[model samples]
Target chain A: MITKFRGLVVAGAVALALSQPVMAENVEVDPWEGFNRAMFNFNDGLDTYALKPVTKGYKAVMPDMAEEGVHNFFENLADIGTLINNLLQGKFENAGKDFARVSFNSTFGLAGFIDVASPMGIEKHEEDFGQTFGYWGASSGPYVVLPFFGPTTVRDGIGMYPDTLVDPVYHLDDTGARNALYLTRVIDTRAQLLASEKLISGDKYTFIRDAYLQKREFDIADGDVENYDESNF
Target chain B: MLNIIEGEMLMKKSLIALAVAGALTAPMVAQADATLYGSFRVALMSADDQDLDLRDESTRIGIKGDVDLGLEGTKGLFHWEGQLETTDSDAYDAGTGTFAARLAYLGATGDWGTALAGRQYHPHYLWVNIPTDIFNTATSDAGEWAQLGNNQHKRQDNTLAYLTPVMGGFQAALGLVIAGSGDDADDDVDGYNVAAKYSANGLYLAASYGDVDAIDRETWGVAATYDIDALKLVARYEEQENAGVEDEATEVGAIYNFGEGLSAKLRYSNLELNGNDGDQWAAEVEQKLGKGRVYVGYFDYDSDAEALAAKYVDRLAIGYRVDF
Candidate 1:
C-alpha cells in the first residue's frame, strides 16, 4: 500500500510537470511604402488645432508650474519610449515625440485635467513600439503611414486593434462620440509633443518618417542601432 | 508548488478521514461532532520538440476541510478548507516545503455569520475568476490583477476574515492581512488591509483597500458579477499607488456552463501603470473536459506615454488536467 501510494503520488507529480505549456508571442509589421502623407497631415492639423488651445489655457492658468511639470512628465515618460526606440533602432529616434507622449498621457490620464503632470506630482515616461516589439520578439517589417493613425508597421498595425479596443473612446457605442473622443485624445496627446517641433530642423514629415523607421528597425534588432542611416532625411 | 500540494494533500486526507468517521457515527450519537475534508489533483502534458523543454506547471493536488463544533439553535459552528499544489511550479509549490494553498483556515457558522482565521484568499479573488476568459494551463491572473503593491492582493498569510451570514440574498465579508513595511529598520509588520464583498444569487460585487505603513502603497478595487442563463459574466477594477507610482487594472470575463460537467471561458485584463501611465492587456480562454481541462492565452502592453509601454505575449497549448 505504501509503495502504491508513492507510485500514485509520483505519477501525479510527473503528470503535473508535463502539463505546463509555453507559447510564442511575436508580431511583425511590414512598412507601408507609399501614399497617405495627406492623411497624416490632416490628423496632425486637427491635433495641432485642439492642443494649441489647451496648451494656451494651461499656460494662462498656472504657467510656471505647468511648464515645469509638463517638462518633467515628458522627460519621465520618455524613459520607456527611449527604451522602445533603442530596442527598435540602435540610436533612439523621435526622441522628442517619445518624450512628449509620456508627458501628455501623465497629465491628462492621472492628474484628471491635464495639469500637464504637475498637480499629480508625477513624472512622464518614454516607451516606443520598437522596445515593445523587442520585448515580444516581434519583427518590424516595412513602415507604413496609416490614414488617420499616422506612422506604423504591419505588426504595429495589427497591434493597433487591441490598443484601440482597450481605449476608453473605442468602447463607446456612438460612432460620432467615439470619433470625437478619439480625436480629443489624439489632440491632447499631440499637444504635449509641440516642444519637439523646434528640435527638428529639416523636412518635418520625412524626418519623422525616417526616424520612425529607424526606431522600428532598432526594435526588430533589440536596440542594435548600428545598421541604419542617420543623415539622409 | 509541490511542497504546498503535499501539505495540502496531507491536510485533506486527514480532514476527509475525520469527516467520514463523524458521518458514520452521526445517527447513533446524541452529542455534536466535528469533521474535516479536502481534495487532490494531478495532470500530464507533452510536446514534440526536444528543444522546447516545456513543463506543465499547473498540475497539482490538494486537500481541505473543517472540524465541526456541535451546538444548538444555529449557534455551534465549524468549517475549514484549502487548495494546495504538489509540484515545483513557479507559484504555490516551489518544492523544498514551500506551499501555496489558497485557503487554510478554520471558520464557524452561526447567528454572527462566519469568522475565519489563518491564511486565506482575499475577497478580490472572486473578481480574478471572472477575467479568465480563456482557460489555459498557465495563468497570469495573480501577477496581473491580485497584488496591491509590487505584491499581489490574492492569497495572503496571517489574515483574519469575517463573513456575515447570508441575509436577503446578500452576503458580505471583511479581511485583515499582515503586510511588511519596506523600511529596513522596522520589522516586517507593514500594516493591514480591509476588504468587503457582497453576493446575491449569481450577482456578486466587492471592494477592498490596503495600506502599507511607511510607503504610500495603497489600493482600492471594485468588482461585479452577473450571469446570463448558463453564462456567467464578470468585471473588475483595481487602483493602487506606491508613493509616486500609481497602477490601475481592469478586467472583463465570461464563463459558459454547458452543463453535464463541461464549460468554456474567456477573460481579458488591462493594467495601467501611472507613474508613467502605461498600460498592459491580456486575453485568454479555456474548455472543460471530464476530469481535465484545455486552454490558451494572449497578452499585450503598450503606451503612447513615455512611462507606459506595450508588449505582447501569446500562448497556445492543450493538456489534460484532473483533480481527485
Candidate 2:
C-alpha cells in the first residue's frame, strides 16, 4: 500500500516537471495558476467539510494533555526523517544531537509519548529532503497545491516523494493500521493549527501561499538568512 | 536497566553542557526565537477599611510565531493568548477556573509595519497609556475606565488594526472595530481607536483618539516622556466627551532607576468627572529578579463624587511576576 502511494507521488512529480517550461514561461515562477487555484479550493473544501469538523470534535472530546501526547508520538516518528535530512545537508553536529534526542526519548519517554528530550538540553530540529534540496541551491520553481497535503513548491513537492520513502509510516505493512496512524497524525497536526485560524485576513489563498513560501525559505536556511531585513516588520 | 542510567547521565551532563551551549549561542533576531513561553505573577493587596489579601493580577500565557514572506519584505504573524484566574483572590470579578481567550489575532507585516484583524489591543489605548501603564495595576491613564462612558478600549473583538512603519522617530497606528455583536449599522467602526507615537534619543511623544460608538462617547489624549539616564519624567492630558457632558484629566510622574534591577517612581493624577473632581497619588518601587519583577506600591485616592464623598481610600500592594 505504501509503495503504491509512493509510486503515484513520483509519477505526478514527473508529469508536472515534463510540462514545465512552456507552462511556466509567462508567469515569474507559477505557470500552473489555474490548476493550483482549483487544487487550493479543493483542499479548502476538504478542510472545511472533513478535517476541520473532525479536529474540532477531537479537541472537544480529548484532554489537552492526551492530545499533546499524540502529537509528541508522531513527532518522534518524524525525527528519523529529520536526522537523515540533517546528515544529507552536512549538518553533522545537529544530526548527532538529534540522534541522541530520539534515542533517549524513545527508550525512556515510552516511545515519545512524553517529550523527555527537550529538557535534556536537546532541542528539536525539523529537517526534510525539501530543506536539503534548498540547502544544495535548488530553486523553489513554482507553487503548487497538493490534493490533500495543501501547499508546496515544485522542489518541495518532489522532496516529499523522497521523504515518504524514509518515513516509518511508509514501511508499516498492515494497510488499515498504517492508514489509521497516518490519518491520526494528519488530524492532530491540523487540530493544533485550528486555534490560530482566527488571524487570517483578505484572501486565504494568497495569505497562505505567501506564508508557505517564506516559511520554506526560513526553514531551508535554518533561520540564518543573511539578507534578512528586520525593519520591514 | 541501562536506559535508566543513560537517562540519569544525560540529565546530569546536560545541565552544564546546556548552560555552556546557551552561553556560546549568539543573540539572534526575535522572530521564532523561542517557543512554549508563559509568565507567572502573584500579588498581595491591602486597601483602606479592607483586609489584606493575595490576588491573581491578570496572569496570561500565549503561543505566537512569525514567518517571513519571500516577497518584498513581508512576514506572516500569529498570536493566541489566554488569561487564567489562578488565585482565590482574583482582582477581576467573575473568576472562573479555566483559561479564556484574552487575545486572538492573525495578520502580516511588511514595510507597512504590522496589520492584523481579530481581537487585539487598541493602539490608541496603548500609546496614550504608555507611561502610566508602567505601573502594574494602572492599565491605562485613568482607572475606572467605564466611568461616564470613558472606558479604555483595551481589547475589542472583530477589530482590524494597523501600525505604520516607523520612520525617523515616528510610528502611527489605527484600529477599526465592528462589534459583530449587533446587526445595527452603527456597530461598524463603533469602537475605533487611532494614535501616533514618536520616540528617539530618550524622548517619547504620543497622541490618540478613541470612540465607543455604542455608548456615543469619545476620548482623546496626549502624552510625553523624557528619559535622562537614570531619571525619567512623564506628563499627560486627556479629555472625554459624551452627549453634551465632558471630563478632563492630567497626570505627571517621575521614575528613577537605581541600577542593577531596582527602580522607584511617583505619580499624581487629577480628573474632573463632569462636575466632580478627584485625585490619586501613588509611589512605587521595583526590583528585577530573573525573568520576573517584584514590586511594592502605595496609592491614595480622594474623590468628591456624591456616593464616595466619605469613602476616601488608600491601597498598598506588593507583587511578583515572571515570564518563561
Candidate 3:
C-alpha cells in the first residue's frame, strides 16, 4: 500500500515545488550564528530532497476529505496536550474549552476526523511544553536548530524530554506501526508548510528564527498579541 | 462537510414542521437558560479480584444555569450532576440502570461572597483531594481508600457552603454537611468543613478542617504545591481523631511534564490509623490521544490488614477519559 503511495507523493512534490516562487524575507536573529546557519542548510537539503516531496505526494493522493480528516485527527490529539498545559498555567476556562473540543470532535466528529466544535463557535488552541515553561516565566533563551528535527530552542530542547515521556506514539509497542504513524504525522505537518513556504522572503534562517520566537511568544500569551503583523506568522 | 449539506436539505423539507414546533416551544425554551455539560468516561480493566472488569469512571451528566436577579452585582447560580452507571457488575448481573447524584447545589455570588445550599461537597474534599485526582478510573477516588479513607469530600447531601471572594491571592470557604434531619437524630448536621487557600507565583497552599458530628470525629489537613521548571511538587498532611483514636496521614507527590500532553505522576502516602499503619505508592503516565486522554498506572498497598499484608503489590490499571 505504501510503495504505490510513494510514487504519487514524489510526483506531486516535484510539481508543487516547481510551482512555488522562491521568495526570502530578511530575518535577523541567530543565537548560535554559525551552528544554526549550518543546521538550516542541512534541514533545507533534507526537506528539498526528501520530506517535501513525500508530503506533496501525500496531499496529491489523499482526497480532500481524507486529508482534512488526517489533519483534524492530529489536531484533536494535540488539544489533549494543550489541555494539560492550560491546567498547568491555571487557565481553567481555556482548559475547559479544549475539553469541550476534544469531547465534541472525538465523538460527533468521529475520532476528530472532523472539527465539529469550531462551527459551534469554539476556538481551537495549541500549546507545547516549551510554551508551558514560557508561561511559568522561563525565557526561550537562545534559538537552536536540531539535526533531523527542524527549528527549536534551548528552553524548548529541555522541554522536549517531558513531552517525549507522554507521547502516545512511543506508547505503541509495535515498532513498525509506531514508526509508520510517526512518519505520517511528520509528513502531514510538512505538507502544511508547503503553502506557507511561499511566504518567506530574504534570509530564510532569520525569517524562520524570528517567526519561531514570535510564534512561541504568541502561543505563551495564548494569542493575546496586539497589532500583530505577518512577521509573527 | 456532509452533515451541513444534509442538515440544510433536512431543514428545507421540514420548514413547515419546524415553524409549528418553534412557535409552541420558543417561549418555554426562552424562559430558562441552562447549559448541558458532563464528563462521560468508561474503561475496561482487570477487576479487583483479578477478573476482567469493565467499569464506569464517575460518568456523569449535568446542567447549570444562571439568573440575573436585577440587583446590582448579584446573580443566582444552580448546578446539578448525576452519574450514569455503565458496565456496573451489579447492573450487568441484574440488568438494571442506576442514576446516582454527584453534585447538586444552588448558590448566589455578590460583592460579599457566594453562598450555596443543597446536596453539596464539603469544602475539605475540594481543597485537599483535587491534586491527586488525576486518573480517569483509578484516581484518588478509588485508590486513596487504601490509605486516606473517606476523609476527602466526594459530596454530601443536605449541605451548605460559603466562599469568600479572593483577595491578595487568598480565598476561604466554610461548609456543612447534614447527616439527617429527624425527630430522633441528636445532631442533624453531621459535618462542618472549612478551608482556606493562597496562590502566587506558581506556588499554592491550602488548609481544611472538618468536624464529623455523627461519628464524633474531627479532621484537619494542609496541602501545598510548587511548580519549578517542568516539575511540580505536592505535599499533604492530615490528622484526624475518630472514635477517640487518633489517625494521621502524610502524602508526597511529584508530577513532571514530559511536554505538553504527556506527563508522569508519582505519589506516596503513609498513614497511621489508631495503632495500625499503612502505606500506598502509586505511579501513572498519561498521554493525550485523538479520542480522549489515556493513562497507565501501577498501585501498591501495604497495610496492617491480613489481606493486604500477605501480598503488597495491588493493582495495575489503564483507562481513557473524555467529557462534553
The lDDT leader among the candidates is 2
What does candidate 2 score on TM? 0.50
Q: Give the runs in model 3 whose Cα sits over 4 Å from its true position.
A: A1-233, B1-31, B47-49, B89-97, B138-142, B146-152, B180-184, B303-313
Whose TM-score is higher: candidate 1's or candidate 2's? 2
Instruction: Give interface RMSD, per candidate.
Output: 20.2, 18.4, 10.6
Tens-digit lDDT track of model 3 for A30-142: 44778888998999999999988888899999998899899998888888888887888888657756766776577557778999767655678887789899889998777
Clashes of 2: 1
Q: Please state what fraction of the native interface contacts candidate 2 reproduces.
A: 0.00
Candidate 2: where are CA atoms >4 Å away? A1-233, B1-34, B89-97, B138-150, B180-183, B303-312
Please give the TM-score that candidate 3 achieves against the real structure.
0.52
lDDT of 1 by residue, B1-324 (tens): 999999999999999999999998876673444443333333232222213223444443344444455664344333344435554455444453333354566666678787777766655553333332234444342224322332455656676777777777566666665443244345455545665666666776767676656565677777778877978887777787768687876667666654443344456556666544433343333334455443333334443322342122232333335545
Cα-based TM-score, every candidate: 0.43, 0.50, 0.52
In angstroms, what RMSD does candidate 1 have relative to the true structure?
A: 27.6
lDDT for each of the candidates? 0.52, 0.76, 0.75
Q: How many pairs collide in each candidate, listed in order? A: 84, 1, 11
Docking class of 2: incorrect
TM-score of chain A of each: 0.46, 0.85, 0.82
lDDT of 2: 0.76
**Of candidates 3 and 2, the better by lDDT:** 2
